[model samples]
Target: MACTLLRRLACLALLALAGCTHSDFRPDYPRVASTVLPVPADAPLAAYATRVTAGHGSDSGLRLISDSNDALLARIALANRAVHSLDLQYYMFHSDATGGLLAQRLLAAADRGVRVRLLLDDLHVAGKDKLLRVLDGHRNIEIRLFNPFLERNASMWGMGKQFAGDFSRLNRRMHNKAMIADGAMAVVGGRNIGDEYFDASEGVNFRDLDVLTVGPVVAQIGQMFDRYWNSEQSYPIGAFHHDTPGPEKLEELRKDMDAHARQFSQGSYAHSLVARVGDLAHEVPGTEWAWGPTTYLADDPDKSNPQADSAGLNMAPQIRAWMDGAQHRLTLISPYFVPGPKGVAYLQGMRERGVAVDVLTNSLASTDAGNVYVAYASYRVALLKSGVQLFELKPDAGRGRHGSHFFGSSSGGNSLHAKAIVVDEEHAFVGSMNLDPRSVHLNTEDGVIVDSHALAQALLAIFADATKPNHAYQVLLDDKDRVYWQGKEPGQPMVRYDTAPQTSWWRRFKVNAGGLLPIESLL
Candidate 1:
């Protein structure tokens, strides 16, 4: 009898514990039917890059940059003007000056009835006060959050509450950074909205790149935003305050974020880009920009191959395939590179086939995601021994300054944020895809595969700046197998070293350490 009573008591306690929690994906909202974005039937993925071109960088229409300060500001300004209907999406839109200021410009544009759509990842919005309310209320503005975790009022659930609750599911992140305006011009590539991206970071800013285009391509990107906007993946802010009722004052509060577009000096970063945009659009040569025709290739769960939806046309496989079959030299610039065994074997085979392969990634010191660093490190030896030319960004890139793009310095303006590949002086791939497992298995990212001689030549010019002696660390293992870095100048002797903390050895340890954890695919 005593044992029975004690067992019953323990069972009751367990039931009580289970009753107290709720699921991360709440049920307050209706169970919306899932649907993937339907790709336009008229435009297939094979239309783009059907033809090829080279030596087009001399056309004088391309703008290139190796730094993030005034140059970036120019690009941003042009980006802002390019948008007649702006769709800005990013993971981190900080509340700092850079974010605040960009918000101001965007809000100002919305006020002009330009039809602005802002989709921010919900991680930072959970407890951010007045900010969300004000933005949500904008007249012509629509803001949505992706994959939100809402806490229940304990008002509902039928045994579904028995599951452990999770409010912070950090594994799934929306890492796409794109801006589209006017339906004809789009800026797509690697950039998040923050001080770091805008060069407002006095100590450092991301060494990032974005391409501005005025073509049918912008319409394709616009369709992508429409899918995410209407998907079950995104939720509106009005739904967050369910029973408490959304306040009517959200409208008046919305006007406050638009206080600074005019404050930017005429020649400042934001202003000049706006001026150049007119020129860029005017210079759009309508006579066959692509060798054949252009098509937008995007990821969708429904149409993917293998499972027809599992990996969804990942850029890694696409880029890897391109590298595997390339006839000449292939250069890689992926800040977060993680080539598993197969990726290694594939690259090795390519090298053995006589394709000159070179790679540029953040030195262990400069990476912010240490966990990813470790995953990448596991393949480091495989890459070096494969006879593939391996190079890491020096701690100090951009003219020997600690805060330059030569190294992926978090404090120095240059972080190896470019996700690009140049092949044999013939073609190039630029977009938001980073070469990593997490990016491969998860996340919905987009980028354009341009096979234009002009575009490829333009990309090559930028690559020239990125690989200069002062900006990049040429990884030289020398015949003795001793690891050394060559940079600082053209004729400088190589400096021997094991690893670096100048970028942060701690971060590398953390990344490699994270490799020990069981949920690597989750990372």
Candidate 2:
């Protein structure tokens, strides 16, 4: 790929740092084979904004497409179909089956003379940049790294390391996963470039979701890329990537990718991806995409984001604003739910009013991030005491561990990775911003304040229609004068628990202990 002079300079800077040959580390890219899929003729977010040309012509074209399972792959395939350009930005890009499949698709797109640009965070490049370099050097592809730390520079592991660490910038990370194709359509949401993220889960897959748009929002997605691309903060991988061994090493990687892809092709996740693909694209026609209002936005380290705040965006204040502003109901879904005292108070206050509140989070045994689950476990009493509707997904649920469903069971593997809020179902906010402290106070989050009745309703409709069981549990005082609980779903009757937590002794210890740790500030 023809890199810019600025990119060349960055390459040189990285080259001056330390690295070795690429044959040393196993690449993270996985693979997934071909499959059928459904397609959605969803409208872009910008279509509803002010118009200059009227209809789709006046709009900015398709800006984003969000989906879990097959829906995500279908959108990616659409981008792969683009002959002109492809731009990708993400925090992590694994070398797994799904990852390799996407890579193959991108390479195929590149073969069509498309301009391919990839920007990835440096945090994950450790011992793996060489394989990426081989691809980055492709005639039609260019890659860059953001906020990298040169690992080989340390003479030993002590003073040199400390000195280099001081000089290097590694505190912040780029967590956005964005894709823009041909400058006509874009996808801006929470999925990173990985197999589990894109539905290669044989055991289970992330129950993640994203938003897609076709309209002027394309400009926003592209603009975000343009800004980050040209920013000094981004470093080119050319110089940073060390040399690779002979074709033997390359062949080994290729073999692993192929095998992984074969595995996923037979997995349930691949089937789901195929189905969603067909659903979203088979019937759409004309210059205009399906119609609805959507917003494309980007959140960096800004004064408004909690990560940028000096004292941090305390859960109390931010939630109070969101809750105090709520006119009807607030529904929050976070895989990892940790509501501090302020969150409890805010939700309680909302309950005191006429507002209805509901919360969805992973069960203790089901959560992949155990620490966060612990924090959430500790807050159970606080939430139940305040009269909030609480739902805990069963460990065996499809959207449980690893975000995938039971292999042969009628389960949904995709977990609730959505960081969203439905306020009266009239307006919603969907983005990488979780309700947890890390999102509100420590991590850089981004989302748009969507003001569209149709879109909000549609999203709520999805939340409602999906038979994804929501087990509601209410805290109770038993006749024995001890606290207990009952769990109920839509069709099933209530199941009682001897203890209010419905958890094991070990699980309780883990969560409560995690709650008492000093690292609550970090997710």
Candidate 3:
């Protein structure tokens, strides 16, 4: 998602001002990084690999990581246990506490002779090139950015000018997120590296989900990472910099990273991870396994800049096939849902054929993306009238049953970020793809389709909890054909709203006004 509207305007002003002062500055575009080091396929994850392979036959071992703390802990464990290599990719890797802690771990892994490759989208790479370049100097570590901006050293205005001239090329982004360790295990989901994603943020925390998998799926994920790592869009950090870091600076960076990791390891968070991975490490018995066939789906990296003649390589068509096979019901959990006319008509047909369709998305008050809510609100009545059950997640969701531990806790607000689909209680999908136009038409996306009844039940249970009265407000129209929000409060009568009751009047006004803009496709 782009920055908040207000922030974007602020940035635009800064860029405009900078262009006046530094119009002559120009930066060089770098060459691609070296190819990924060969994977030692025979090197198994010490204690974890045997259990995933033995007794499971060709089936993959799948486990869900719903808790923010646990999800981060799983990543730390996988990194700590990786033997041969680690390939980590993300759209955002903030230099906050979480990012710093993981950076420390990755550096240590590299120091120990493990090859580590980090690929990130260029949208968030502004102002961080120097720091990343220092890390790239490490012998065993390499850093690359995807589709970087050309005027790397330009002032804000210079950037704005460059963006203006190259809007279409710079607008498309790589929104894929995944982490593979030692070719033996992988974690894929809706998370980016930040304190908010791992329950450490005091502000807005996300209710996100990720899956840890082993077996044949890991190999497929490795291949997907290679495709992007070696793609034309990726460029080495060394290419943008004048030269690699000198010895003194590299030593200082290493020392700072060591101190950060030492401090993090002494904290309760690291202690908890140390305990869980040990307990969770073992062979997953057949009875406990969610055994089934799995298909990994990913849009071609070049799909970000779609060409009419490009091979038909997209995740949408593959996803449509799964939807087509839904025999009973369809459940969707998308944070930024803009099911346009065609999507609505398709769902209507499904309902007509006796299929139950349910959707869970963010309420105007809960959503972090205001413009997106505007676009989605325009389709509310149409979706409801077409027999689609709709629920908007409460800002205070994850407060019942599971509480903060279920979703990451925050004092400011809570919003849905997970993108998943459940079809007919037989299959489930987990990934970074939202059901918005941006995901389908502009950005590169990826996901996994698991044909496991057990996993399906787990996801359905989560959906049930999320849609409960205390967790969400049902969107409905009264007898007078007026749209209102409805939910019951504990020890009180049910409540209703002419508008989103949790949001302030000003916020609602801003969102409604944004609906008038001609940017539904962008949202």
Candidate 4:
């Protein structure tokens, strides 16, 4: 009891100190306005997109990218094929191998005279200023940070202090992710620019999803990008950094990035990715593309403003409408599944109406965010009682794949990072928005909703494979209402775990402890 009091006192002291600290940074810079570059008539990507989406009227061509290597390769391929412009917006862009490789590709594209606009959320850019400045130094490349911190070089504690001082502003984030090439084709999904997201991580890799699209949808996505790009929240890197890096510095960084890319290419994973390059043509062939009516859904950039009336700017209502309109079945795949009271009530209502709802989310062992799992766990019994079928991805789910899953076969751990919903196996929604309060209210998110039976079935097929006993645990309740996990491995016997399977006591303790806190809404 004394220890608890001491810790509380310490926290209070820290908060007091944070309250005393004032931000020295301001957003009073000359904001230069720019929009998405128009695609030239003879642009290669424009020609390809036009040829593929011809005679379809306003319908868009869509292809799902379930494999991690292919997702990275597709972005690189898009960059390579881009003739006019490349617009990239992401929540996080790491400086790891996959990020460096993509950065190298973007640099090469910029050298080819393609205008590159890279907009990233500022939450994760603390130690990446030099690299971002160097990228911004490029003649044809520009970078912006959204909802950035006032303190540029803040340490962990400093960041905490800043957040404590300005909780309302710092709490909000931009969670959108997209890559539009030549204003013709775009890759929009849950992935950011990172090795783990691309299945290149040696540790935990994300099992995510993305869709490559062309036609009218790309134009809509470009408009969405423009909305955020020119918003008051997005500030150019030059706004913070007055002194630009010299050409010599840029050349040095270029050589370093190129060397890193060369080294990364020498690896066996790179070879495998390169070997499958030809497979992309088969996947994205004009005839094979799924033609559909697609809607681009995004939250307004003003959602981040503390005083802004942003309720009408949310995408949650549209998503809820999609789910509410489900007549027969609904399948949801979210890594961080924290469905609060309203969500639970809504799902229960759907089940009451005889809708078959299946949800695939991260298990305690496989989840990166334990607090989210705890919050989600609170509703599991309620969800199960309401006839909502639940499945949790196993930590080793990626082991079965030879070299295809988002995380490589050799990865020590794997986690589900895909956020998707299929309604009645006829409509599909894929994007960065998760079914959590943070995504619904706190963060700015975007995605594509395609009214295509084929696309819905394709996404469902991926979900079906992932929910197999070997890859995931089918959650169930006993006669006594106690929850248990049912799972089976390939050629192995079925087993049941009364507690969270494959998890440590320490991990479980942390989750339980986290639940005692009043932070479920924040999860």
Candidate closest to the true structure, highest lDDT = 4
lDDT of each: 0.59, 0.58, 0.80, 0.88
Give the lDDT of residue 270 in candidate 2.
70
* Model 3 lDDT per residue over 283-334, tens place: 4454555667777778887876644344675788789888999889999999
**How do the residues 1-523 of candidate 1 rate in per-residue lDDT, one tens digit apiece?**
9999999997787677566754444346443322222233222121221111233332212223334443345334544553246677777788776677667667667667556677776656654625655665666666777755464232334223332343124345567776765554456777777777756666656667666554455567777777767765677665565432244554444444444434544435555445543333233343534331233445552221123346434555665666555787787778888877877987898888888888878766566666766777667666888787766665456454433342332345456777877777666666667877666766667766655566666566666666765666666666776655666655676455556535556655666667898665645
Which sequence of candidate numbers ranks them by lDDT, best first? 4, 3, 1, 2
Model 2 regions more than 4 Å off: 1-67, 152-171, 242-293, 301-325, 398-414, 465-485, 488-492, 498-504
For model 1, the superposed segments whose C-alpha errors exceed 4 Å read 1-84, 152-170, 243-295, 301-315, 400-413, 478-482, 489-492, 501-515
TM-score-wise, the better of 1 and 4 is 4
Q: Taking the tens digit of each residue's C-alpha lDDT, what string does model 4 give over 315-339?
A: 8898888778899999999999989
Minimum summed lDDT over a 10-residue window in model 2 is located at 30-39
lDDT of 1: 0.59
- Tell me how far the alpha carbon of residue 212 in candidate 1 is from the true structure, in angstroms, after superposition: 0.8
Instruction: Give the candidates in order of TM-score, highest first.
Output: 4, 3, 1, 2
Name the top TM-score candidate. Answer: 4
TM-score for each candidate, following the candidate numbering: 0.75, 0.73, 0.90, 0.95
lDDT for residue 498 in candidate 2, whole number 0-100 = 66
- In model 1, the worst 10-residue window by lDDT is 44-53
156-225 per-residue lDDT for model 2 (tens digits): 4422342233332344556667776666555666677775665455555565556655555666677767
- Supply every candidate's count of residue pairs whose N, Cα or C atoms clash at under 3 angstroms: 27, 59, 4, 0
